[model samples]
Target: MNTIAEHIADFLKEYPPFDNLTFQELSDIATNIRVINLEKHAVLFQINDLLHDSFYVVASGVINLTTIADAEETIINKCHEGDIFGLRPFFAKNNYMMTAKAREESIIYAIPIAVFRPFVANNSDVLNFLLENFAINSRHAKDNVNSNGKLISDTAFYVDQQSEMQYIQSLAYNNSPLTTESNSIIKDVAILMTESMVDNIVICEKNNPIGIVTNADLSSKIATGRYPITETIDKIMSSPVVTVIENVSLAEAQLLMLKNNVTHLCVTKDGTSKSAVKGIISEHDLIVAQASNPGVLIKEIKRSQLPKDLKQIRDRLSDLIQNSIQKNIPISHISNIASEINLAIIKRAVELSILDLGSPPARFAWLSIGSQGRKEQLLLTDQDSILIFEDVAPEKYREVKDYFLRLAKRTTSILEKVGYEYCPNGHMGSNMLWCKSLTDWTKQYNSWMNTPGENSNDLSSIFFDYEIVFGEPKIEEVIENVIFKNAVNNTLFFDFLGNDALKRNSPLSFFKKFIVEEEGPHKTKFDIKTRALMPLIDAARLLILNANIKGIKNTYLRFKQLAITDSKNAEIYLSCAEAFLTLSKFRTVEGLKNDDSGQYINLREMSKTDKEKLKNALTPMKDLEELIKSKFQLTQFS
Candidate 1:
């Protein structure tokens, strides 16, 4: 009886739903608990299984909530000590959407729903929390996108859930468009239609639509010589023009188009020819606007000829990221897609730069530094990179160097034109020192490692995320190998890197207020980049470097891998990864709000609750830095 009460209390204390019950109440409930023991792979609940009077809580071991993911049996969530299971049946029609199986020999507490219902009915907060969490947990959006993989939905929920996605397919158009004078000649009227790319040109007097000349009018009257080409367009135009007002919904627009058998709709101020036409919305525009495929955004970026268009694409990308985040995308998939978008943007920038240069003297590879190099950059920040060219003899070095330098300068200028600010520290490829051959880069890295100094450390940081944006893939691999080989077992270097990484604590105080920067560009503001992101970023880099790991350059993934390897620090590292996601979200939002990098936060404007949460988040980051310092023996270096 004592063990039963203690076990129930133990499990209740760890989870929210049961936490509402007091010890005496829980003890009274626990006495009637039915403890069930199961062997490995034994099913606790199956699909369509009738409601069991009792819900489950893990008491002695682990349970796997297995579902179909990517076409195979997969465990989506693991339930451990004090974790509840089989509750989907209690609140959700008493049928299991997923099967719960014991991963090993385990004992589970069966808390009868009959006794729990009364407590839940009386406690709104308890009930509300369960309801919300249950939806979030059970739907678990990452695996639900496609319905075919085992434990994953492969049926394309991203495509399937259009209504849920809230996409508005229709373009708002105004009727009663500004039209040419009724007596305007064919050439003059034709120019206006051509410039506007309108299918039809409206003829008006006093800016009031009186008639419309479409493609048919030009073909019949102008081409057939039924009327002279130089004659007034009023002879060919159709009179009694139909008009509509702006703010029509997609359905209404479609209906109007169908009813009038017209391909274009003119939106006006008052839905009459007497009112000025605001704009035209074509059927093609409406269809394209409805496109849900993410690829369209990339295509738009590629086709953009101006900086403002690319900027709009970037803004769209931000919206896309927020959508993915809100839709509960797995961070991995989100980063992967985002990385592709960044590459597309950079590639287009490179293409534009190449166009500007007219022609290149030699083959070269453009490298992206920092987060971008790692295939992990999810946000735009300072452009850190260099240019690597094929080798040139000493006599010809200046010729080759000048050519690449000019190219690099043009490339960065175009990227800056597209909104990636140049590196404040002059780490961009345009720097003469940065435009080097692969051999020079390899040799340079060897020198940095052998003769390590503060400058070398700074160089190492820049080189760590060296991703080749253009040029030969082989040379990029060669440069990477050189850096990796030198970095491995370079304990002194790791110590230095570790010390640098842990130098800043998370940005908030124990009291949860932003720690104001003492001086420099952000003297009055909170420097979130240095104090919050950089510390975590540096720690992740050291851990990955120390492990001799490659490819996973994103900080979150680095910490995730570290957690898998370092059992002792697994929880701390996992929490760090979560905090990073939250912090990244916060920073991105802050940047979007203020039109800066979002690194320099304005603390005074933040809500008290937010300040408290921000402060709370920094502790884990501080602890993470401490762990890195102790693990790497960075204090010895300090």
Candidate 2:
């Protein structure tokens, strides 16, 4: 009973855009498509050829896209099975800009614009896919054309109108939300969730929503041996639930979720949490609303069992980042999503490493230091990690330490396989110096706090930002408490840290020109990390340490917290937070473009607008450095 059109429709249903379409709709589209076979080296289209009435999707084999330059063919990209090409010309209604030829014997399904245009006009997901493809292809063509090389305005290639319109539309949510009381036992709650066939439940107090618990919370908090089934639900529930009004647009809801880093949004009578719960919108709801997207990337990361699979997910993550940036989404939102994905990848790596090495010999915690600990690692960078195991007796110490060292090596290898490079300075957990017992780590922190020197300062800056990536969190809490207690009373250490914070001079010169490296391989390039971000980072660490604040590792978050605690200097700290976000975004975009760490930036390559933005972002760095100098009384010491 399966006709060729029906067969093709079934295959199309497996991929996106088409996957979002109904079976009937896909069958209709399949009827309009023409299946064409080509031998190797067969030309599908050529440069400057008149626009075809149809666009092609490779059903099998490969298609090579190349441009003719200087009378030579320069390959731009290769389109494999299920990959769509020739869509750009149709969207632009222009002649072919590149030559498409069969790289191998190929079969492509050519769908006419008359048939596809209707679907694109009706389905926002389809339109978004096409627009994204157009943006990517156009950017590639521009880069290839300018390969002889000059910087083109990146702003010109970003497509926002269609995506923005889609985002502003009303979102669909479950009007009748399942709920439970805060006093309910975890076992009862689980039974209720099973009976209702729900993955999440809102905990209410007198018909007012107060918290939420998802299957993830149950698995991580209960099944992990951290809590008992008879424990009260409130113990594991996320408090002060994020909420939205019934009439909120999808974009607004998404922004709220991203801002709060939550997956569930309780739809209330009003927008505030005090209002009665009316409905619920979860990340799964958004996934169904917007086809395979960043949320899907998270799902994929969690599902992946192999390191290579995470690499593929990460590659898709880059595209997601590009699409988000081009759509002009807030940089913080993008960073939050990226950080979640990064953490998920690391978590999975640790899980797999545990399987490889068996269970830990003792309770230990894994710490991600540096940018990752700050939750701002947007690009693939060298890994900086440490391992801390529970203290043991003298005879047991060697056995426990050796077991953790092997585990750390396996974990780091898995992460490296997943694209996180090994630390260049031997800062990873595999090193004996970083992998230590709890007592040893506490002693180490005390030593650094008491003896403030160049080496200690360097270690402080790197180690202080640490966040537990995996394992027993209480171990990290104990270590952090020790560090905080020591740091608060160490005036001499503050002076040393303040001097280190002031090491990077202001990024701007007297005439307001950027003070860039004038010599060496990085001539005229700005080191945004050192000259701009680090001063703010160091200042935040020192000021927060002085305030005896612990567990706030992120620079921007530390500033935000500092603003709330230190009202007089709130304005300066808030400005620094904004500047840090701007600089982080700039670095991420630059890294994506050049395929390298976005540390040093060539001002000559940046557009005028970007240069101006960078200059403005740097203004807060000097003010922050001055605040640090005055607070710690460091002017006389350095």
Q: Which candidate comes out best when scored by TM-score?
A: 1
Compared to the true structure, candidate 2 yields what TM-score? 0.56
Worst 10 residues of 1 by lDDT: 148-157
| Clashing residue pairs for model 2 | none
Candidate 1 matches the true fold with a TM-score of 0.57
Q: Once model 1 is optimally superposed onto the true structure by TM-score, how far is the C-alpha of residue 542 displaced, in angstroms?
A: 0.6
TM-score of each: 0.57, 0.56
Candidate 2 overall Cα lDDT vs. reference? 0.77
Candidate 1 C-alpha error for residue 104, in Å = 29
Q: State the C-alpha lDDT per candidate.
A: 0.68, 0.77
Candidate 1, 372-402: lDDT as tens digits = 8766565667788888888877888788888
Cα lDDT tens digits for candidate 2, 130-154: 5443434233443334221111111
Error of 2 at 58 (Å): 52
In model 2, the worst 10-residue window by lDDT is: 148-157
